[model samples]
Target: MIFRHTRLIMGTALLAVALPAVPAMAQDADEARIKKLEAEVRALQRKVFPGGDGRYFEPQIDSSAPVTTTSSSPASTTAVTDILARLDALEASLQRLTGQVEVNSNAVRDLESRLAALESGAAPAVAADNLLPDEQPLPAAAGPAPTPPPAPAASGPSAQRLAAVQAIAKPQTDDPGDDEYSYGFRLWNAGFYPEAQQQLAMFVEKYPRHPRATYGRNLLGRAYLDDGKPREAAPWFLKNYQEDRNAERAPDSLLYLAESMIALGDTNRACIALAEFGETYPAIAAGRLSNQYEANRKKVTCN
Candidate 1:
């Protein structure tokens, strides 16, 4: 994804995947952004190749001969200082473009991988969480009543508690991924919500591509939800879905997002999230998540 000057080819595939399922107006807006970015790129190219020929790999600092300025103009207007400033500007622009390309490229590759993973399955694109064995879903009636966001607890975890978690000296199990997740799950299940949140956050960060990572992210949101911080919880679920709907926990994240929305008294947005979940995971809505999905729909009063 890093666009080294030596390999600066922009592929059409990067341009091909507009944000999936975007409305026509949003699609147009995305295109406009791309066009603006393209225009900026072309402007940079022209500066790098003044002759419009791709002869130079980088902006020429001092080609062969040294440059000396002998001008009556102000010091700020001296050719060398101005040229140096322009070069600095060019380097900054290149860095910006490089970062943008890297992000877009990674997203495209992620989408492609998800497509391949879900090819045999009924759903379209989904997350690595899908590869793991399904966890028992919460009963519809078990959904929590709406609650306000909570203030932080008085203090951080006790030193002894941190030491115990750190002292968990299990050997690297064959399924370390499961081992990692189970530790956090155990913490959460035991009502160590803050500690569980911390450990789950760590698990997701350290093993982002692991099958359990996606679930860890959803669980992070759930931890917030269960802790009576729906304001804090909504974002995690919404973002997990927005980023990669193929994620095994993405449907769960969406469901939780709606739940968070309801808790926050945003029933209109809650209905919208429910609608999106139904639209994005129709088969899931009819199957594994059917009960929870239906419960959310009825709660939101969506048609």
Candidate 2:
């Protein structure tokens, strides 16, 4: 669990850092080429997991058969019911992780936008070459060398356009009102999960509808994950997923939910989570889900 949480943080950071480079590096290439590559990757992923959509980034899971748990006494049944209830809570936590992943995905998009801005802002090394004036140098022999025309200065509009592009290409600014969220993230980055959780919880409450609410929830889930509380993280991740269904985070939420279930020794629900991840985000499902699926399958009770 600790390793998983660390990987999640590193992955998010890497994605955020890498996205901005795409536009800056590929500016000279045809836009069609860029889109084509993305399309090709999406297509390939979909092909790998037949019937997969390219929208979300969920992983696949095993779908062989359901296992039946035998319980005789009423107390045994009630305990089973309690386990199922815990599973429900786990599901909810995963939704929150989904939201955080979405926020990270959006950040990548924003970075891409900034890269485009950088590409567009780069001015030509030299103004349009004046062939007529430069080679001839001034026709002194032809006539009284006309006053060498002064070089034309760049227009104001061009300058303004450059400034606008540069501004747009810069990273997103921190929200002034989200001080607590900021603090929470800082603590999370520093490995203080408990303090981070408390701060993040307050941030969610104080700014329930703020733009960073999804991110806050996501961080909260991460806090739980880092604390080795996958079950607690499940509901938050799930909430994040539902709130932002199309976000990259949704599939991630599903993935973690399944993991949490497996950890709690609930193979059936884990499979259910994995299957849902594949169904909702097929493109991502097959590539990321195999290991978890196999692991859970080994523990299955049903034939």
Give the top-scoring candidate (lDDT): 1
Reference-based lDDT, residue 262, model 1 = 80
Poorest 10 consecutive residues by lDDT, candidate 1: 137-146
On a 0 to 100 scale, what is the lDDT of residue 150 in model 1? 36
- What tens-digit string does per-residue lDDT give for candidate 2 at 213-292? 77887778778777886655655665665567675455666666666656656555565566566666776655776665
List TM-score per model, in order: 0.46, 0.37
Candidate 1 backbone collisions, by pair: 125-246, 126-246, 126-247, 127-246, 127-247
Worst 10 residues of 2 by lDDT: 138-147
Model 1, span 1-303: residue lDDT tens: 236422433642366374546898877876766665554454455454556354544443333444343323474368669899999999999999999999999978865553333222211223567644742222221123212233358865679877866665433679887787888887777676776777777777678788887788788888878988665566566556655789899999988888887876666667667777787799999999999988877776755
Separate clash counts for every candidate: 5, 27
Instruction: Identify the runs in model 1 with alpha carbons over 4 angstroms from their true place.
Output: 1-177
lDDT of the candidates, in the order given: 0.66, 0.57
C-alpha lDDT (0 to 100) for residue 103 of candidate 1: 100
Q: Candidate 1, TM-score vs. the true structure?
A: 0.46
lDDT of 2: 0.57
